[model samples]
Target: MVKTAKKNKIHEQLTPKTVVIKIAKWFLILFFGIYTLFPLVWLFVTSLKTNAEYFDNPFSLPAVIQFQNYVNAFSQANLGRMIINSITVSVIATFINIMAAAMASYAISRFQFKGKEAIFAMFSAGVMVPLNALMVPYFTIFSRAGLLDSLNSLRILYAAIGLPMSVFIVRGFMDSFPREIEEAAYVDGCGFYGRFLRIVLPLTKTGLVTAATFQFLTCWNEFVYANLLTSSPATKTIQIGIRYFTNQFTTDYVSMYAAIVIAIIPSIIGYMLFQEQIISGLTSGAVKG
Candidate 1:
């Protein structure tokens, strides 16, 4: 049996079709790798250039490296304050969003009750709704509640805005989780909450991490509602701080690029931390989205 398997493997490796397929896979991987990372490399390069160098040749190397652009992003602008605000808002909103999603998805997926599917459907439908269309009503409601010009407004809206998608992803993951495990937990005298807290929650780590990654990124990058809801600099987020270098009359292009690079760092960090879980979660049938 061992000799036969080895012979088959050697035969497969030597086949022209298999060789061609392997070559093509490597080629495509290289192509996509460059495609995705090229823009980031170009942006970093441009961020180091002066306005004169950028204008003279957008693609050329900088004559003098401008390390001050990064310093200016912090000194000249409120980038520091805005980064803190973004971090605070994103973390709090992600926690709330994930907790709510976990409970909602668990109940909807595990319990067979009348209108449960309908509730899930309604949540799913929210993803299709255009947020721009609701801006007027949301503005009125927040205005009445006096949440306008507050980070609390973003916290609430960000959690609510991504709730639909978060529910969708987590629910899909829960749906595939085996009922037999919970049944065994019940046989061991575990109550519903106990089983969920100990077994279900811990086992769903990948799905939760995936959902949290999405929720955090959404909250971090959200600009439209952040702009509409907050007017004062005290409530402004990093997304709004990126626009600091622009006006009708003039623009600081290099400084804006530097701010953008700074803005992208947290997202890259988040992805690097959760990328394993995110990739596995998506591949494990949680991407019914």
Candidate 2:
């Protein structure tokens, strides 16, 4: 009797409030999952359809899958070359942005110097200055400098645009780290650079990964600067190349859809790989001093 009563009491402890909360949580999860995936699913289906088939049955599965759409899209967009350009620009910019941001962040977080706060405030303000607002100035400057159609121009612009946010994120993470560990390293005669490279960098891997991911994504998806600053196929990024599928009169729907799907694959893979780190870094950074 006592055992049965205890079991009943345990079951009753999970009240209607708990059940409602669980149901709401699952409902939100299901809603967002469908919301996020629906467009990709539609795009994939559309990519498999011919123009006639797409117009005939807009929302249904293709009678015959058109794998050639991907081939045509890849060839027509010169995506192979564009992909190489994007990868190169994104990787180089991301690396430089993270390295520079990490160094700046470390100094800001660890050192006390005149005008340090002012400098950091400037970086924070840079984050608020919309990229579009600088487009004209950047275009004029690059054109006059004869760098308008070069990969180096994109690389420099991407890194500069991403630096402010990267510095903010890395500095926030650095502020959260215990000062005692760094103090101990200093006492042991570790130089400032040595302490930063060995102690700080390794400990802040999540923050670095988060910043790198953001920088890479920004470079990958940037359309305005690439569209304005680059003209040659050799210099254009994937985002700009993808626009070739549509013009004023004719639009290649199948190829356009296929190109879009291909364009998004890298971003998807990147997010999947570093999702945990992004979440952790943001959460920790949010609470830091």
Candidate 3:
């Protein structure tokens, strides 16, 4: 009876401490959540404020909602074309990057050939190289090939830049999958393409989605190559197009804020939708022995 009473007392003491720890965890999450979301809230607020209200009464509430800012942003900068161009480039680059990386990762992960380890190591070393040094060579090659000032140039560059990282991620996920799965497909008379497309691809959907999301976001946000490669307004992406908000005379804060809010919406929606898959893919096989 004494022992039972002591055990109960110890458990009761631990319960409050556990509850306090949980509260602390939640409080920390709330703090970071508000901290992260505050900028987005401010962008929306600034978009709603008029130029006069923004300058004259900077801290005061907006006297009137300004719907024209969004309209002007779309019409003045030809942002509609820019959005379309960005969408096309991001989608094309992401598809090529994910598919090519998946194939390369599968080969490196599954197959055993002579000098394979050396080749894989070489590929891995690319992850450490800085992109800035490659810009001159890229410019020269694209110019010589007559690909400059074209959408194809943007797509190719985005895919090339994103490939090494995607390869690393897809290879990691592929390593976690069992070889027996592919062998079973082979037993069913599946060839290399069939085994890869039917057996391997389905299992790696989470990893592929994560890779594609990352590639899409990277391509969409890329500005240096876009600004350097494209000359015409039709080929310009939203990131480059946003520069129009800063003309030589004065910057249009209201229009710029609205455009930024608009541009961020698509990426946020995509990430939220694939949040679970991305988390799982990123952490699947880091501890394998």
TM-score of each candidate structure, all chains considered together: 0.91, 0.93, 0.91
TM-score between candidate 3 and the true structure:
0.91
What is the C-alpha lDDT profile of model 3 across 1-289, one tens digit per residue? 9999999988886797888998999999999999999888888888888887888866566788888999988987889999999999999999999999999999999989998778778777888988877889999999999999999999999998888888888888898889998888888899999988988899988889988999999998888999999999978999887888898888888898889988888899989999998888777745675
Give the top-scoring candidate (TM-score): 2
Give the range where candidate 2 is weakest over 10 consecutive residues by summed lDDT: 280-289
Worst 10 residues of 3 by lDDT: 280-289
Q: What is the lDDT of residue 264 in candidate 2?
A: 92
Residue pairs of candidate 2 with colliding backbone atoms: none
RMSD of each: 2.7, 1.9, 2.8
Give candidate 3's error at residue 130 in angstroms: 2.3
lDDT of 2 by residue, 1-289 (tens): 9999999987886789878998999999999999999989999999999988888888989999999999998889899999999999999999999999999998898889999999999998899999999988999988999898999999999999998999988998888888999999999999988988999999999999999999999999999999989998889888987789999998889888999999999999999999999999888887744
Ranking by TM-score: 2, 3, 1
lDDT, residue 46, candidate 2: 98
Residue 121 CA error for candidate 1 (Å)? 0.9
lDDT of each: 0.93, 0.92, 0.88
User: Which lDDT tens digits does candidate 1 get at residues 1-289?
Assistant: 9999999999989899989999999999999999999999999999999999999999999989999999988887789999999999999999999999999999999888999989999999999999999999999999999999999999999998889999999988898888999999999999989999999989988889999999999999999999999999989999999999998998999999999999999999999988999999889863443
Residue-level lDDT for 236 in candidate 3 = 94
